[model samples]
Target chain A: MHIDLHPAGTAAALAVLGTEISETIGARVSALNHAVCAAHLVGVIETVPAFASLLVRYDPLLTDYDALCAQLRRLASGLNDEAAAQGRTVEIPVCYGGPYGEDLPFVASHAGLSEEEVIRLHSERPYRIYMLGFLPGFPYLGGLNERLFTPRLQAPRTRSPGGAVGSGGQQAGSCPRESPGGWQLIGRTPLRLFDPDRPLPYAAGDFIRFVPISEREFCALEAKKEGARP
Target chain B: MKILVPGPLTTVQDMGRRAHAAKGYPECGACDKYALALGNLLCGNEEGQAALEMTLSGATVAFEKPALFVLSGAQANATLDDRPVPMHEPVRACAGSTLQIGPFAEGLRGYLCVRGGIAVPPVLGNRSTDLKCHIGGLQGRALRSGDVLPIGPEPSGTTAESLRHAAGILREKPWLLRPRTAHAYLENQVIPLLRAVPGPQQDAFTEEGMRAFFSGLYGVTPDSNRMGIKLSGPSVQTIDGSDILSDGIVEGSVQISANGQPILMLADHQTTGGYAKIATVITPDLSAAAQLRPGQTAAFRAIDVREGVRLCRETAQQLRYIKELTIHA
Candidate 1:
């Protein structure tokens, strides 16, 4: 609901208030990050939001640890109010099952559901972007329905092709780049979540809802976007 | 211009890789960032300029044209044209002079910086060589014999007059780039107490396991590299045997594998890891950790997130002061 400010060095520590590790954590972290970033220019060089924590890299020369911690605390405590003032949402499209989702069967079986049911459960809920990490523009989506919860494969693939949709535990998201991953892939999204060349990538509080589409619709959207990108 | 013979482990490095840790890539850059800074300062280059990172053994390079260079870091028996050359000081070499680096007497890593920085293509916003992907640096591998490297245009005002002026300032006053001040704690085996802030997975380890981590002595294993350091010490047990989903890991993260041995992730570590990270070393001590050899012993000291932040700020101030002195000098 709010951010918790802890005393850090001369700087103040800013963390997501609750410890209940849930799907909405990323959005909350992202909201807090935007607030803190907008407030302090020198103390905050970068903010790295993880599953449960945000690592803030600051310039010590300009600000001492105590001063920074104080600033972080002040900023974090005000995040909820700031987020309420400016709200935005983003929608994502996905093609579940079939070729895009090779491991659909495995995930369905693991979660004790049929393939169709798995897709229904996955696309039914609106997910929150908990954080952006693991790669450039990689979004960590939270709020996967418990019925869809599944463990990752014991041995990870050497490389998971970029844009492969995957799920693990109660979380699911697509890979932004080819990398070794252990998440159980279920479907793929047509959207490119991260493009370094793009001005604004996915932000933390942005909403991601999977709009199920057929192969034809996916191809049409891809073509339209490609034509527009000249 | 060409590598006569590649020494043991030489690679192109800058200050450190950053903003890419979320993807499982460790900030793999120079083992000694301060030394790299000094090399750059001596050559009147920017802080993050690329330079050759030489390990215990030195490398031999044949220059096609005269170059302004500076050697810093571990004291190495370096020679040019069969004559011994001074280190930590700028030197000018003729076109045909062969620079040969011999065995190091004190430290493990050395840095050789040219006037205009290395001319390698930048990858992912950096020119530092990552040994894992075998990308970056000279053809993504250690420098070897017969490798012709292209030297960029030298910096303006790097003439004898300017160098003499810089040298005069350094000689007249106690320079902030003094390697001894930063490395004083490293002389004896009394490793500086490393402070670590607990991570999200710290709760997974048993209280005793955590205690053992702080109280027990851990030796850096021979397998340690840019990716991670394999620490050998007491076996640590976690609260649950269940595995965790892969998540982002950062430089200085101490990830405990299923086997109970702790692996301290370093620069060039994978962006993400499945193992539970109990703690993350504060950024200030990371440089010291980077310089640790395989046989070195390190002790971990637990500090709260607040204290860790304080240490980071103080260290940053120290570095800034050093940089300011360099500019003024």
Candidate 2:
């Protein structure tokens, strides 16, 4: 595999693995990211793995672009698929078709299916967390059923509550916080996707499995979380 | 110190949460690093120590103990007990004294650095306020009225004599501490020119689009925030539309949206974005870009990586010069 280095900025560089978007590209990107972090290169701050590239942020005073690029190319050559398979499958509890998911009916109608089928299809399999972006702890997931694909809302709500399980086009993920979003919301989770005190339970290469829960269970878990907080 | 009146948006910031971008946390910090570092240096605090970043307007604070503080970035009419506090200089605040920092007369953001940095418990290794995630800095939100912030213990080796001497200088001759160079906004230029290098996705844009980006005068939109500075101007036509497979983003990325408007990513920008970026504002010019307020216009000029690195080094040298000047004075 060959890596192409592009200047993201003065302090950062994007190591493009390939142009085409696929699981192979993502796995290679993940491997390079893991390898870079393990190497502990001087001045390297962090590595963010996306669909087709790995963004390496570093300090220019300690390391320059050419040096970092040469190092990145060496790491990319020996990448293995084991890094892709190492991610844990985190099960997330979700309550479907309620106040938390106001767009459930719309999504169901758009997909020509009942609300029950929608939930079953969404919760059937584990989806890969391709990357986290747009917001802190917000996962960009893949592996959604094509039959369940629904268009995003034309006018997104000004504030969508955190833990919102949403789908737009072929993608599906949870909103980590209360922010404006256009995704077709079909369910909600009580768990906090993002908490500063708690290390993010999931990462870029992890898989997220949605577990269907009743509204009562959702409230109980929600209250338990609130009570746990000081 | 107690906040009597929290301005429009004020948050505690440091150099930002480094090494956390991989987990999708924003590098939230002072929009203008030079200003924050200058204030911190003046107050004898570590360069990356936490300070208060006030946007548009400044806060009114009441100190419960004697403290040494400095105001920098965006000229603000600040006073301690109604006596004017000079910008970029350390001044003393007596116990029970109320200091009011008026709205910025120039630029958009200001930094308030006390000798001991703001001592909010760090989250993810940073004291910065991540407003969206509700993490770090005063419970991950802006300062509110009556909010009492803890000041960190003074750095070791700081003696009472040094504090007294430093505090006395402001009263004796405040102008001695002022930097001779004025802020770029204070200059007579109608539009600030930001130097940038071609971005990773420069090939995605058509020749006309690149021309528009370089030649166009873009006005900063009110919708701009710490996340990104949205600009409106001549439409930058693209080759295959502006959308790209989401890729990693960095501060100062000039992304052109489907509508052809440019959005300059800032400190709080997301880790990744889908729009095509045509250029990245150089490190030295990022502070200048950050200082641009809504309704102001800015132009972009292209430079190579060699020049960008040189400019970055020059800025560091300038900071060192300021630190030495302050020490001798």
By TM-score, who's the top model here?
2
TM-score of chain A of each: 0.81, 0.93
Residue B111 alpha-carbon offset, candidate 2, angstroms = 1.3
Q: Give lDDT tens digits, candidate 2, residues B38-85.
A: 788777777789999999999999999998898988889998998998
- What tens digits encode model 1's per-residue C-alpha lDDT throughout B38-104? 7776776776789988877888998889988888877888888998877766788899999998978
Q: Number of clashes in every candidate structure?
A: 27, 0
The DockQ for candidate 1, computed on C-alphas, is: 0.17
Quote the positional error of residue B4 for candidate 2 in Å.
2.6
DockQ metric for all predictions: 0.17, 0.61
State in Å the error of residue B88, model 2.
1.6
TM-score of each: 0.79, 0.89
Worst 10 residues of 2 chain A by lDDT: A221-230
lDDT for each residue of candidate 1 in A48-80, tens digit (9 for 90 to 100): 566655656555546655666667677766656
